[model samples]
Target chain A: MSQAATTIYVPRDTTTISLGADQVADMIQTSAANEQQRLNVVRNGSRGLYWLEPMLEIDTDRGRVAYGPVMPDDVDDFLATECWREQAGHPLYLGLTEDLPFLKNQQRLTFSKVGLIDPLSVDEYCHLGGFEGLRCALKLSPQETVSQVTDSGLRGRGGAAFPTGKKWQTVLDTRAEQKYIVCNADEGDAGTYADRMMMESDPFALIEGMTIAALAVGASIGYIYLREEYRLSEEVLNAAIRLASEHHFLGDNILDSDKSFSIEVRLGAGAYICGEETALLESLEGKRGMVRAKPPLPAIQGLWQQPTVINNVITLATIPTILAKGPDFYRNFGIGGSRGTMPFQLSGNIKQAGLVELAFGPPLATLLNEFGGGTANGREMKAVQVGGPLGAYLPSTLWHTQLDYEAFATVQAGIGHGGIIVFDDSVDMSEQARFAMEFCAIESCGKCTPCRIGSVRGVEVIDQLGQRDVEFEPDDPERLAQKVLLEDLCETMTLGSLCGLGGMTAFPVLSALKHFSEDFD
Target chain B: MITEMNSTEEHNNGWQASVKRILTELKDKPGALLPVLHAIQTEIGYVPGESVTLIAESLSLSRAEVHGVISFYTFFRSTRGGSHTLQICRSESCQAMGSRELESHAKQSLQIGFDQTTSAGDITLEAVYCLGNCACSPAMRIDHQVYGRVTAEKFDQLVSALRTNVIEVK
Candidate 1:
């Protein structure tokens, strides 16, 4: 038998690609060819460590040693020494890939196989316990499968935090000859990249999870409603779907069973409102992505007036782990109602920004100070916007807030999609507040007046507040009146808007006003 | 006004066949409107006003309905852009990283604001929310290629090279 060729890994994830991983990969290939080196070059997904991206790894007799932030010019020197195999005298060497403090400290459940496998290769995916969930799922009846998910205590990771199993039960209970499972990949949030990372790194997990969902609900067809901006994710997902189909993981009968399920990838035109479930359904049905009034909820009548199950990319991707291991094992990881680990995207002005997958009860301070290693420019971290454009801006005083959904809600904040965007002391909270309104105004679907018009008015009011002089007394009636008016506007938008786009828009504005009032002054 | 209408008419004359072909290929698919519009934009560089009537007829929808979808997405360009398009990020994360300064530099260098094309028709600058590379803040996309940690100097070099047609924008 021939000895297996040594593998050198370089990531093709979009963030890594943006940092010139493609050029670095090309250089390595050229250098290897020039030297006639008989090693295999494999393009893997990111390890969620964005700060150390273009992170290249080499398989050695000991383990996979790491080298990173590698530019094309550095490749010639790297190849000359062949120090990537061991932690030789190379300055870029970081010993074992998994031993890095940023990755070693966290728990990775949903993202276990991410950055560790060749995304396009089903063989590599299966070798690392990929399809075991679907294999176990196929053996159970639909009711039993739903119960397993229900027992796991898994909730929607797409900001709402609704119980995932209950949503599935509704679709399962509804009497329909045809039902649908839609994976919401419209990750339009500004500070979030977990959904995009999972889809790019381990797409088959999403596909497998959706297939398991179809099995649980007795659905025959599924769709992944993806955002338009994610061109790389679309390419990777389509390739993974095609491969899954050939392997009988998707389409027709499953692994010699009588069940039949098929999935398609549908791209959403740019619209933030579509991240709202009902509006997402509207867009998926080939109409304007306007928010639909609930009660004839999507599970009752959705996608051609049939039952449907819609879940976020993270929620669906985490299912494989829940099924592979038992529900108790998954449930044991978190605190309170929140179960399992979430992939937190630590971004913005931070020294070590990346995806940190941990259990639900970690204080925000730990993630910001420890894993994140404080502000990127060595300035003080003044505020952080958790969730997305619509989430609250938490000040340093509130940094001790735990990450559980209920805990975040107690402080009138939300752990929306687990994205925390840090800001340095140089940031102007007044400008950030104005941008919250502006973003809503730009992305609103125009179906609800409060969202469509109130956002525009909100922008005007914020600009007026900004124009007030700093010399004004704390109790100045004219300034106080404007503040009262702004509060009134926020109240109207929060209570009156049809969906979260406008309703939750007030969270950031009010949070900024409450926590960072000096910026407004 | 007469000259403007005549030139628009001439432009429509050039795109009619390709628009028809795209609509014909994608009309049968379910929820075909978005995909059809995307194909037209890809093939013709923009969704021309003249093609709206043809698309509406082919897809059995009203002209307003077709136009509504076209105008809804910031991605679908109604008028023709420059030979190359540069979309700069203005979202919160990027803002925290001096994107406001980058935006100003781009506008000053290109002599155009967001969504405006240069007089020479060589470059168009537009504002986008996020490119999903928040860790490497101050990101921008020229055509479909995303570049990150863009300083004023890097922006100048890229834009100048693109203007001179020294590097392929796509």
Candidate 2:
């Protein structure tokens, strides 16, 4: 590895700021030459404080000593006190990054080395224990590795929350010469960027995780179907892949362990529905992003009729952690069936709107009141939408409910995606309910008749309810007709749609109507 | 309808001027949906409905299709935009942290709708699908500024200081 003194600090993760990193990096390069200091600088991923990004750290006797959110104006001051370990005069310093409460609290199995090392540097990644999981996986039998993951109790973080090891084992059991590993990077759900943050910040982790998936499922090739708008992330991830292939982690004969695995990232033009596992496969095959009939699941016959192991970025990313920490260690973090901490992007009208990693089953109120720091406007919290648009709108009464798969289900809601959108009193419930229908209306892939037509009708029904004018009979038969239509629409959308886009929208819309019907009138 | 690219060699007035001339000539056409949109977007660098009446008369298609197509694609606009068209990808990939809620919040802050320009005429609010940068999901675009893994607070601070000089009818 290169160990020169002058440091370049470009944030590899989307969560990190590069607003001032460029100028600071330039100043560091110039200052080191001016001061006759030996320099080796490379841009690296975020440590994930977010509050203290574009952060520059200096290599010292201990490790990379930290200084952060450094601006162009701080260059001379920073150079004046070069070694941050001794005279770290910068206000951004919170001592070692390991001590930050936001970072320290995280169990960090998936994100273990995310913000620490140079993402593109294969040597740096190895030095910080990057391919250790793959090395360990290569040592074990494929079924044994699958068992290890199964015992680890890791579930998919891509909304469905399915067990990871079982999915791999299913692909392993299925007979196919051209088995594939597909990473669902088509993250369309709102309030979710954990996958993007991990991919951009630690591309190697995803590669390593996918490698593990390939090895466990006895697959050779993998594809990461990402959204089209992430151009910079594509460059960074591809660069990382090149670096990994140059090493023995990605391409043929990885680690020279008699295993040949290769990966590619395909860009989806722009389709929210493609985030679904089967729909993603359809899109990967150069078709429109639409859901497929599921008698034969992706595990059985997927991705051009080959058995496929499909997992979200977070689900695949979690493999390395489950491998290294041991199943028991990873499984000990969460309560009930939810056996690990989930990273949620707390957004919308919340006071503390950023990435939060919390164990499952914490009261929703605690996440909102303590962690989120309550609503953004200080308005009384009206309703909080958990798990993206398809998730339910929980009124304050249900705020005390624990945040877990089962707990949410008991309340007639599901954690479709771990995205919490807070709403203040000013948020019109009827409008939100209307939007839930409208979003479904626009995004439904038109595969199932109920979802395609029902969504459009849902929007119109809500519009009719919201409108003050349209006259009805003295008994208002239209209202009853609309109610019947809504129930039937939700039932059809719930059962008929191929994936969550149509399936989940019913929950939020129904919950809103059931809980906040006053808003509808 | 996908319009093929036209050559600029024969018309030295530049694409923007040609688009204006075309729009002016077609201003009085009734039901000017397909013709105005097709001609203006084809002639100008992009679709700009500066002369609505010219568009209405010349194209002879309904004003509705002209309006809907402009709004639907997310790229077309009725008003002139700032020097930079800062768009944040509000699709599912970027929505993890309340991108939808943040969308409404941002619109409220900018005093603009999905395709409307701000009162200051510095920026326009629009939605885009997956930046393919899901690694840093919850992203947004500010004109050409592509910001990923955006938090509500960061998005607010990003737009708060933006300044640009341009104007047109909404």
Candidate 3:
């Protein structure tokens, strides 16, 4: 086989694709050919530095030198320069890939392979030490495998922060003819895209992670309940499953042993409620995506009334590392109760919006200023919405809170899915608070009255509050009554909702009122 | 009851035959309602009025159950739309990127509201909560192709090209 002189790496990530990466890739191949050069092009996944997407990299003696945000139109002009290593006044040059402070500072445990490898090559995945986790797990007893995860202190990354090992143990102990392992890929959070990135980046890691879960819990069947909006992830996962099956990593009698596991990709309709596990189970049954009450948690009676294990994409994806390197290796990264690294997705008005996989101890200020570099519009920063739409809107005063679960909880905030959405001073807190209630009303499953009905009422109350002239009439009885009623409404929803939809919608509204009360006036 | 019967009668034999084919292919799978619904929507632009009763009967569900499932999710629409579906993200991430103005520009340019088709029947504008493209905010998806950081100028150009059939919507 004749080797190509040089290789060009262009990301096929969703964000890059939307920025016209495919067009750039096509142009690079043609332009290099015209220069009498035999250049190989490989479509890899994004490094999560989205602003520089279509971030083209080339192999050099120093390492993978990067340059980017390259349009198809710029490909010929840059190739014509013939001074790639020397920098030669090219406008898109970003220096070496590893030297970028945004990536160099990251503690990336789960996202290690994301932008570096061709996503679908099973040989490359294995060759780079991929399936060692499953191979290690096969030798241990099911209880032992579960114990390893428990000792690692890994909690569910899917917002609730429940211990993943405890949930798996509940399913493992329960006797049943069949058990199910479901990976919740219904990441509907407005400002988060880590789950989508991981699935599109390294599909095999998820497959391997789920296989380990099935082995630990004695589940024969697995399903990845992916959201419908992620059309690209669907394609990547289907192809990955096919490839893994061919290698005997899946299906009956895997790897010359008496083990069997298979995963099916099930699509969720546009219901945000399905992100809630019980509602997800209901939707998987081909019914309306409604929430189920919790007398019997999903661990004991789930799916078709059988034992089940449901975990978020990050929680499952982290499993392979824990099993491969032992619990201590994974446990040493985090602080307090929250173990391992969290893939914090930074977006919105932030100048350097991207994913930062760091251990759970950095203050919110570090992530916002150091990695994010404040708002993109060069304005003063105002509020930061942590978690998702349901999360609280924090003011500058709260920026010192560390990224730990317990630490964020102290400030009425959360590390839910590790999403940090920055906003400029132009943001109207009252409007954001109103939108929180409106979003809940739109997405609530109607399983409980407070979430279903209270959200609508919350919207109306906020509208009336907005109309009141607080400057002229500080003693207006009607305005005072409405403010009390708004607080009461938030209280009722937090106490009475069946799921997080109602329970947490008040977080943003209440926080906005407490911190940015002037906006309400 | 009479209207229901009339609507079913209006459905051609070809529609019924394809619906039957979809049911036969997916009926045996566990929790097969969603896959069946997706297949039907894929075959036709939207879930027709008459197919609910047929789906209910085939899947051993009540007619109310079928209707409830369709109405519960925003993705499933009851009526057919234009050649292309333009879903603008209305969630916070996009909102922070000035999608509020883009929302206005899109509605004015097409003379349509969310879930409504344009007057010329070339586009259907819809509101989506999020498309998982938050890093590149102010995102909109036309069919499967998502466009990011869309300014009002960019929006106008895409709309004109779409009207002229420059890109395949499907």
Candidate 4:
């Protein structure tokens, strides 16, 4: 009798690899070879259920059977067992990969095929409705393509929340012999891995999106400004680009058409300020990552004084689906002005921390409780910082706010980068506030006085406040003076700073002060 | 101790040669300073101060310009690092998961603070913002290998193992 072939799935995602997934994969491969089992191992992306990472899935005649947090020592027993045939008696077996509540609940439009496909395979990407967008894009005029995006109501996912279609239209209107499409993959924001996940898992999607952008804006060359820490992303993206180019999806005369586009990956050298669009442009030009003054926005005079279309990785990755499906189909998923699905990353002290892609306008409480599964330690949740370091720290009282951009704005918060970092009751909001100032100081480009000098002063003022023991009374002179001074400093930094680096530093500091008043004591 | 000192000097000489070779190879590339700096640090473990002059002269830039670029980034170091680097994420996400306690444990165990090398030259501790493994809080990287859900005990075990050279980290 002929033996049937067995397929084993392992994640090559960074988070999974960090938990010794590679070692587990090696063991599985070696053990299968030694046992002479007809096994094929494929390294796929993370399923976003991190608690069960090193999560190996085996394709059986019944379905895909899952095993989790698998160690190297368990490989022998795993291979010996008939657990793949049935999930009845195995301790590690998790039946059916998709049935997991954490994954099945998510509305994964952008991240639909992340964990399902082999990341680097162009054929796999094509099979999963990848190039249909580019094919659709090739037939449309540049104005029509821009209008499609405008009709979709996609905003910048990189925290600015600017309309993406308008930015593209501006670049399209500009007359330049050589324009560029820059994908901002410099995801330095804490508690955010969506950009990295998109780059590492569905890299070709980002390339396809950028190619679509290139076709839309009439730009021939592009660059992905990637963070330095994402070494794996760099490798995967470059390989995907090469594969796409080889398949005639990129480079000269793409897909036997007049359109041509090429992309190069540029690594940022450990500067958080480089995540800023202007600073990123400066870093790309081999200069200090100082924030450039605006008016001549990057869309107008960027990358050697030529027009450029710069969009975040998620923003670009969302383009393919929008182009393939109609604009209304994409727009129907979201609420209010923030149309479309967002890959909200839950981290910090969360119990079931991972990427949760959902349509906007879900109550903040639902994400914190339902998606995150509350604090990992079962401690009382103190605060949740929506967005990155510069985002506001909201107390539990404000948890009812919706995840829409305008809704967050009403509460003096911005959903910057869609990263929610939960903090338990054990957290000291004062220390967090101080860290905010310190981070700004360390990452400040020193272009503006309010950010460079004011951040240092903000730290000193917060330290002085920590020393004081006065209650939160309006008439308490010493306390009142310090509060006023801190507010003034925040105001200066917010208004006087050259870029968002200085402008948004006040968010965390001021929000912590406002919400966690007891922490100040 | 004397042999160790002599070996350190010999290592410095080798680093100089490697830096020169790297500069020669990457000098002509467009916007090569950052890449050149990255290559030097990758090869020598840290960017030495004297090498800044070498880089500036090769790239036809002022030493101040080179120094500004190097110092602007936290990853580049002016002095030599220890044999292994242990970078603990100090960002709010990791902080929420008792990284502060783990950081204290790491410092006490190594008898060194962040950005400091231990007296034994075994490990250099540094603070990174985020490792993109936020799902696994208290994430740390020992050299290029990232370890997640790192507890005080797990950190200590890794440190001792690294000090003893019992197992290669990767």
Single out the weakest 10-residue window by summed lDDT for candidate 2 chain B: B1-10
Off by over 4 Å in 3: A1-3, A33-36, A83-89, A468-471, B1-13, B166-170
> Candidate 1, residue A428: CA error in Å?
0.8
Flag regions of model 4 displaced more than 4 Å: A73-76, A468-475, B1-17, B166-170
TM-score of 2: 0.77
lDDT of candidate 3 at residue A307, scale 0 to 100: 95
Who wins the DockQ comparison?
Answer: 3
- Candidate maximizing lDDT: 3
TM-score for chain A, candidates 1 onward in order: 0.98, 0.89, 0.97, 0.97
lDDT of 3: 0.90
Candidate 4 structure quality by residue, lDDT tens digits, A1-521:
27786788898988998888898889878877887777788999888888888889988766777898676667667778844455557888888888888888889989988988899988888899989999999999999999999999999999898999999999999999999999999899999999999888889889999999999999998999998888889999999999999999999999999889999998887799989998988888778999889979899998878899989999999999999998999999888999999989999999888899999989999988987889999999999999999999999889999999989999999999999999999988999999999999988999989999999999999998887554456466787798899999999999999999889999999999999978887
lDDT for every model? Answer: 0.89, 0.72, 0.90, 0.89
Q: What value of lDDT does candidate 2 attain over all alpha carbons?
A: 0.72
C-alpha-based local distance difference test score of model 4: 0.89
Candidate 2 local lDDT, residue A305 = 89
lDDT of 4 by residue, B1-170 (tens): 44654555575667768788999998997678888988989888889887787788889999999999888888788888988889999898999998989999888988999899988787899998888989998899988778899999889888878867834552
Model 1: per-residue Cα lDDT over A1-521, one tens digit each: 26566688999988898888999889888877887776688999999888888888999877788997777677777787875556567888888887899899989999999999889999999999999999999998999889999999999999898999999999999998899999999998998999998999999999999999999999989989998888899999999999998999988888888888888888887788889999888888777888988778788898878999999999999999999998999999999998899889988899999999999999999999999999999999999999989899999989999999989999989999988999999999989999999999999999999999999998998888898545677787887888888899999999999889999999999999999999988
Give the lowest summed-lDDT range of ten residues in model 2 chain A. A1-10
User: Residue by residue across A1-521, what tens digits does model 3's lDDT show?
Assistant: 37547777899978899988999888777776776666778899899998888798888888898887787777777677652443736789888899999999999888888999899988888887899999999999999999999999999998999999999999999999999999999999989999999999999899999999999999999999999999999999999999999999998887777999999999998999999999999999998999999959889999989999999999999999999999999999989998989999999999999999999999999999999998899999999999999999999999999999999999988889989999999999999999999999999888799999999999999999898544537667887898899999999999999889999998999999999988887
Clashes of each: 0, 52, 0, 0
TM-score (0 to 1) for chain B of model 3: 0.90
Better of 1 and 2 by TM-score: 1
Which ten-residue region of model 4 chain A has the weakest summed lDDT? A467-476
